[model samples]
Target: MNAFQGRVTAALADPTLKTAIDRTTNTARSKRAAAIAAWPEFAQARELGRDMKDHVIANMEYYLTMFEANAVKTGAKIHWARTGQEACEIVVGICKAAKAKSVTRSKSMLGEEIGLPHALEAAGIERVETDLAEHIIQLAGETPSHIIWPALHKTREQVGELFRAHHTDPGELATVEEMVSSARRNLREKFMAADVGISGANFLIADTGAICTVTNEGNAELTTTPPRVHIVTAGIEKLVPSMVEAMTMLRLLVRSATGAELTQYTTFHAGPKQPGDVDGPEEFHIVLVDAGRTTMLAEGLAEMLRCLRCGACMNHCVVYRQIGGHAYGATYPGPMGSVITPSLDGLETSQDLPRACTLNGQCHEVCPVAIPLPTLIRGWRTKAWVQGYEPLHTAWALRIWEFFALRPVLYQLASNLALRIMPLFAKGGWISKMPLAGGWTRYRDMPIPQGGSFLAQYKKRQAAK
Candidate 1:
């Protein structure tokens, strides 16, 4: 299993996030299922969004060039990074040039993907996470459990404990407010002393060369204003043709992610320092990290870039409920992450991800961008076979199955034979011992290959007619 899959397994099996996810999922189902179920609207919407993303991505070079030109015109500098390592190197170099001793960062997954803080730490820079959930996880020296709500694994009392322990002088007090106050006071010092502020952009407007951040706590502003140098890291596909499209994307983002009408703060920054802006970064640098996006784009899978990342899919997935983000072991997790992460990062490491889903299609339903995630997952399966990574036995079995199915006479004959033999194999109307089914039988009772095959039943009905 790759790090992401391993993490996913660990997360699903994790005593904390498991319980938290279980309760959260159950509660969401109880409280919001009616509303979510009403949205038979998701699948169609996702496809439309996917087309828009694909169209832009197919012409990505043009859009990127336009965005860069606008960004430069706005007096900010943009850097191109072919890989995560290169992106970090460029950011670290900027930090070094500014003589930055510390940086206060909002939740930037790309920064984590590149291990920016570790590199900065190596260069003697102190980095502090400014988001409340992130700060909790950071102080615990752990990764985030949930993408939007990082410390979802940590309960209220657990948070209180973390705060009391991390506080400069604390005997361990109680209450969410006190915990919040302590965290705020502690982070205030880091924010005040930091020389650099770093973040991730939700969308980079190609028309205006502007980047936008949406947050609940108003921390996005603080993250940029406290430091003389503000830097943003973004995946190259984060670009859109104009702020108009960006606005449309944002409208869908908040609603799809948390079911919110709007975020607390939706701030846009164009370039860097301004002539009369009293409080803003003196320099702004946007690092567009290609990593494996270009490869994905080239391979005709660029539709994944249409994601506005509202995270509604994660919120509603059965697997993500049973498991959590940490188990996926990638910067991105949940339904969209299953395909995108492995595609960007590689399946050799993320082989388990495609198998991790139940193929129930909740992800595709919730996806605002309409990326057919399950179909994308099936594509990954084909890619794995093409790479010679899949077992030959499984590949041969697939071919045999496909051949029979394509030949209707042979498939029906085989189905009739299996239906005839199925009853003999069944014990108590269930098959506990079956080939390639150990994983299935581990938790579920496999219904005896029932009522003959669907083809057999359908044929019998046709004959009756």
Candidate 2:
């Protein structure tokens, strides 16, 4: 087994983790199916969403320039980053210029991708996560396991214990609501005292120069509004031409992400606090990150740019459901991650990610933008094979199989010989163990051969007829 498969085997041994993943994924899958089924025009809407994103990607340079111009006009400073280190440096520079002592953040996967928290802490700036799930993992010194629901792998009991250990009081908070209230009380102080706030944008409007964020807890609003310095970090692909296109994408995003028509709050910020505005930031900054996106665009993997950061693909993925997200061991996880991680991190480092999937195509079926995830994964597999990255045993086995497959007489002779000799190893119509097939038979029995070759069966049937 490869390293990725080894991790998956280890994950499968944890029954508690399996139960948590199964319950969460099953619930999310049911809700998303029901939500999509309720809308008669969802199919057309999905196609339209895909088309809009494709257009933006094709004309990415033009839209990015237009966005920068409009944002400058609205008095927002824009910064472009070509690498993760550059992105982190830009953020730290802004904080340092503002003399920020404490920074509060809303959940941004871009922030995670660039390792912003470590950068901030290394600079002696306090970094606080305001989102509930993010806050939980942050306190636990762990990374997000899923995109939308970062802590889905943790049970309520686990969260309660985490809160008890982290919170000041050891009070008996027996229910989820009490635990949430405890976390809120602790995070509220951080929000009020924050000197700088960082957030991720769901959609960036090129025409209006708006940065849009969607959240259930309203923490993103607080993160953007209360602090004196507000910074938005987002992938370059988040840009849309207008509010209409943004709205259409939002419709698909919320439904695919959480099975909701809309999140509790969807806030849009065009610039810093206006002259008449009561509560808003004094300075606004938008950072466009292009760590590996330009490379992806040049390659044929630009189809992945259509993703809305919705978790539906992972929610419905059989491999993700079985092994959970942590086994992938990358920033993103599941089917979409399998395709994009290899492109961003290179096929050499992330080769196991593509092999983690079953290529069952369920991810393609449920994708809000209809990205061909399975086909992209197969492309990676082909790339790996062509580059001679295939395991030695697998390569030899395929060569042997191909040699016999090309010669029908030898194939039939070998098959008949196997059929006659296999009974020596059969017990109760099953093979309990085998030398070369331990991977398959280790956990379960493999069924013994039941009849002669398919060609023999066909010939006998023809003669009887």
Top-scoring candidate (TM-score): 2
Candidate 2 lDDT score at position 111: 94
**Candidate 1 off by > 4 Å:** 1-12, 25-48, 169-178, 392-437, 444-451, 463-465
lDDT of 1 by residue, 416-447 (tens): 88777756756887877666677566545677
Worst 10 residues of 2 by lDDT: 435-444
Give each model's whole-structure lDDT. 0.78, 0.90
Candidate 2 — which pairs collide?
Answer: none
lDDT winner among the candidates?
2
Instruction: Report RMSD for candidate 1.
Output: 3.6
TM-score of each: 0.86, 0.92
Model 1's lDDT to the true fold? 0.78
- Angstrom error of the Cα, residue 454, model 1: value is 1.7
Candidate 2 residue runs with Cα over 4 Å from true position: 408-435, 441-465
